[model samples]
Target: MTPESAALPGAMHPTDQSTQGCTANGEMILVVEDDVELLELLGTLLKSAGYQVAMAKDGMTALESVTRGGVQPDLILADFNLPGAINGLQMITQLRMALHRSMPAIILTGDISRLTSRDVAFEHCVQLNKPAKLKEVTFVIASLLAQQRNAKNDSERPGQFAPGIARSSIIFVVDRDDLFRHTIRGVLESHGYAVHDYATSEAFLADYAPGPPACLLIDAHLPGMEGVELLHQLRKNGDDLPAVVISGSNEVSIAVDAMKAGASDFIEKPFGRSEMLQSIARALEHSQDANKKLAWMQEATHCIDSLTLRQRQVMDMVLAGFASKHIAAQLGISQRTVENHRAAVMTRTHSKSIPALARVALAADLRV
Candidate 1:
């Protein structure tokens, strides 16, 4: 149906209004969702809450409504999983670029986990999990629109800082169920992710590729190295690999154990497409963050490793909370020499203070 047909009479229609005017006010709301019933439901809900509401069935229609029809709303409440070339995320991104403004948005979806930090990083944007109550939805919409108005009033305030895009990573599937594992791999591959699978944790570890960013999706009841135990082992081995545990039962105790064992997320068996995708996406986002930290730590460690033996001794003593005079006495060196070595240690590590040096050492896992 066309945008006009989807709205209640005299409520929302194609606009002759400028994008600037629409963005400057909180008078209209654009709803983009594929579910017909939910679409009508939302239109009614928003109208009752005293707001003009426009509706679209998919992302392409939503994008065209704004770009071609000049029907940009002050706030967008869209579902992430839309049909056609653009999804909800793509449509919002395009709109932001086209309008040259960070429009307020509410990302309504079944899975918030699937979205990375960069995807919902815009100002006045909030994400709500699907099947939310109407009251809660309206509350978020009103809250964001209020913030938008406040920001517009400021006029000279700077926009929010947007982080760089997150890198997609490989997904490792460890499930003894051959059929289930195959199905999972097929789904993830179709979504454009690199995938690898193993029936046991031992096999996964033996052939693991440490150079690339990766996350694990393991069945809780494996033949050997039970899923939670595998997470425990990885954590014990100092591996911060993000993981999701799946089980046939939805036992609270099992989920608790998995979480305690360092699993990033947990899902019950026989999950649907959205469920699986959200879990994997959440896990991969964690993996991306872990990789970033790993990179920073490696660089810091390399810097620390370059210090001379005497400088290193001085650094260690400072880290141990030794006074400068005591450190000099122990090293059988003059206080002036000790001070010089300490200064060299600071310069080499790029640290301004003892605590700063300590953080670098701990983060890089160097000997303190």
Candidate 2:
């Protein structure tokens, strides 16, 4: 359908009362779908709500547009079933690599049963079934964009510094068995780890927030929303909290599913204290690595944001391995002038050498 024809009229429009509460403020959205009609409908809806929309018919086109720096979208809305080998999740991953940062995304699919925990494991990404209500879609988009804005603001706040070290050493245990919870809590507490035990997954999720160096010991079989599903939900919400799954039966399929759901490790029932401790140690180590990468990404983003337009151009050329003379010629300036801008770029980025400057640019995903 044509863009004009796809536009909803008056009361049926996105700007109507149903979606008025979640109006967009010029945030760019990249919509990818193989269906032309659906794609046009999404573009029109988003544009009507004040978002700048970019359309892609398939995953490859979306990747090419993002990597080529054609559009820097704030959020991506992609259909899971694409024509090519690249799916919605893979396209999001490629875009994240190009930007040198995680971007918010939502996967729209008709068959919710076909989706596995691994498909939506990306940070700041969620999946919605097809035929979703327009109000629901608008609310999710607004929430994700608002989260991004809040995170950026928090990073820029004064007196705020990235915590290179882990926070509190707390372990949360979620199991239906009272005896097991008591025994595990005692064992963990004896080993110098603070343990909080909950009777069900619901209780744990209600009290849980992302904080500190922590791990979750969840039973594989729970009354509702099994352990692996809980882990998947946490990961989808951008929570990097390490988790270990414990099951009564040593089923290989269960272990594999838990791992796919972002669990650090899986342990069979009747585990020893030493075994549990080892799993916790490994999970904490993984958390530390994630924290370090997050810090580096944040620092690189800040440094890149501090550069002026000319300085950014110079930095990009340097990263591209262009010599000062060639860069000056391309930019229509003298070689000495190029060197001056180059020096300023290095100083502002706090990069001592060409290689260091290149690393910063790469980490920030700046395209030349």
Give the best candidate by TM-score.
Answer: 2
TM-score of each: 0.38, 0.42
Q: List candidate 2 stretches off by more than 4 Å.
A: 1-17, 114-118, 121-124, 152-368
| RMSD, every candidate, angstroms | 14.7, 21.8
Cα lDDT of model 2 by residue, 1-368, tens digit: 54423442211223232434455779999999888877878888789778999999999999888878578989999888899988886687668656745568888776555223323631236877666656667778988887787774432121122222213478899999786687567546545567889988899998988776788989989998899999999989999788888887755457656766777677765554445666676677657777765677689789989988988887777766678999999999999999999888888778765534654665565543
Per-residue alpha-carbon lDDT of candidate 1 for residues 1-368, written as tens digits (9 for 90 to 100): 54323432322233332222222133789999888877887787677666888899998888888889998688888888889998786687667656655567877766645323224532224776655555566666777777777774532111221112113568899988785677667556645567899999889989985667677889888887799888888888888888888887755456556765767667765444445565566556546667865776797788788999999899888877677899989999999999999999899889754544665665566655
Off by over 4 Å in 1: 1-26, 114-118, 122-124, 152-368
Worst 10 residues of 1 by lDDT: 156-165
Model 2 lDDT, residue 134, Cα:
62
